[model samples]
Target: MTSAPPLAPSFDAARALRQARETFDIEAAAVAGLKNRLTDAFSRSVQLMLEVRGRVVVMGMGKSGHIGRKIAATLASTGTPAMFVHPGEASHGDLGMIQVNDVVVAISNSGESGEITVLLPVLKRQGVPLIAITGGLQSTLARHATEVLDGGVDKEACPLNLAPTASTTAQLALGDALAVALLDARGFKAEDFARSHPGGALGRKLLTHVSDVMRSGEDVPRVAPDTAFGDMMREMSAKGGITAVVDAHQQVLGVFTDGDLRRLIENGIDLRTKCAKDVMHLRPRSIRPDALAVDAAELMEEHRITCVLVVESDGSLVGMVHIGDLMRAKVI
Candidate 1:
């Protein structure tokens, strides 16, 4: 028998790109479907959540279990304390973790899992509210649930239409929707998130204070505006900062620095005979003492300055901030 011709090597980059784009487009279309369908089911889900006296219990199997863990984590970090419980484990005696006041959030793409189906009755008997996140609106799990959240995708991104791709993406986006809605309803603030993420860079940025970093009192270099340029140099050098604030009536009139002295010399000004006001940088950039350290950093960058005078709201000089202070705080 004649052998079939060897299969040709299909070399089509455009075909691969088209397939990749199709997957993302399918997921996008599925998530977009959830935007206009805020039904009584969604309201009941939120209401049951609000009324519960205990934490939310998230459960799923397979790929949904992975998504459930992430959803639980996001909800926990955003003001709703929740934990993932594997339905398979629950049948193996983990269901005892479910309290009478807790709410059960069961996630299954098809709304039917042998493990999850086995535990539905026990949860119902315990009077735990069951919130189902599933792809099918008429599945047995949806019918058994106290509230059903539909995350149905028109089709799977898998070439065989078998793998959980677009459906799982839709489930995650809906899970995030629930978390963000609850977060805003609870008046969750940036500071609240910072408390939960204290080791993160954002926590450091939001919680940092001016008093924690500013050079206060005598450590902040200051001198009278009428002080001679020669005397100002001594003050600036003794303080070890780049500049000295020239104060008049307790408010900064300008600043004199090593740079200013160099400019003064190059400009033919007699250093010993000139006053600080005559050669100082007039009306220099300053920040309020109560401003966030990050805001101070921004002002420093915007003006291309290495240091700034910390002033009171009434314009009186209070302290100083430097690039070094921001770097030490690890906020730069």
Candidate 2:
């Protein structure tokens, strides 16, 4: 018969909480310690990466490898071209990915990872610069490195003093510092980062133009200035909740919305005899089709209105954007 599963040990919430606090203290100190250790080598490393013609190839083993992957992604998204290659795979044939123009960032807490050490001579032969993130300054990886970054920590947060908790934190923090320095050196901006992250929220805000999300053609609700109030209300209800008042050349005269209708009724104005021009708000806020979708959202928010007209330079109405449209596009 199959044996039953073993029961879990008794819980210790207080001890668990104490251990967690100690872990935070140890890791925070590990990262903070790096600030004191920063020397000219750190700036040189950034300069080397900034001048690289090709990508930054990050390599590490196990946990360091995980941190290396994140570093590569951060660097790539921040304007530096980078990629992660597994060290073990490099031993076989993936080393071919490293070109002379590429800069290799190798992470090893002990600075003597056998897999990485074995590739040092080959990297040197290929003339690829090696930046080592290691706790071992006198170790083999550092000896072959073009630049040495101190990633040492006094101890691990692990109770046994064996796990890589503090060391990995230091490595990650150092990697982030390098990326930030290179980003500034390269003059990378938010818009440039957004181009690399087109599907993200910031990308949508910066890259999405007014023409992309506005309702155009028949979807836009528009009526001549002399249109009957009842007819304008029909157009508004059929479209969204707003109608644009336009002239013979389709230039925007004004706009009327559900908000205006309520205010007119509150003032006891008889709408049955009025036309679109009589009730429309003059000089309604408008945006151009070339502006960012986020700008449209900001316009609606600033005026406390639900919609705005997309117009040409000459004030001709082209499209309409509603708050709901911006919401659906997630520009806000």
Reference-based TM-score of each model? 0.82, 0.96
Stretches of candidate 1 exceeding 4 Å from the true structure: 1-12, 36-38, 216-219, 223-231, 238-241, 245-254, 273-284, 311-318
> Model 2, 284-313: lDDT tens per residue?
999999999999999988889889899999
* Number of the top-ranking candidate, with lDDT as the measure: 2
lDDT (Cα, tens digit) per residue for candidate 1, span 1-332: 99999997987999889999999898888889877665778877877776678999999899999999999999998889899999999998899999998999999988878999988888888888899999878988999998999888889999999999988898899889889878878889998998888777887788776666889888888888687766777888888645555555678777876666677679886667877677777778888877788888999899887888888888788889888998999877
RMSD of each: 4.9, 1.6
47: Cα error in model 1, Å:
2.5
Stretch of 10 with least lDDT, candidate 2: 299-308
lDDT of 1: 0.84
The candidate scoring highest on TM-score is 2
Model 1 vs truth, CA RMSD: 4.9
Error of 2 at 124 (Å): 0.7
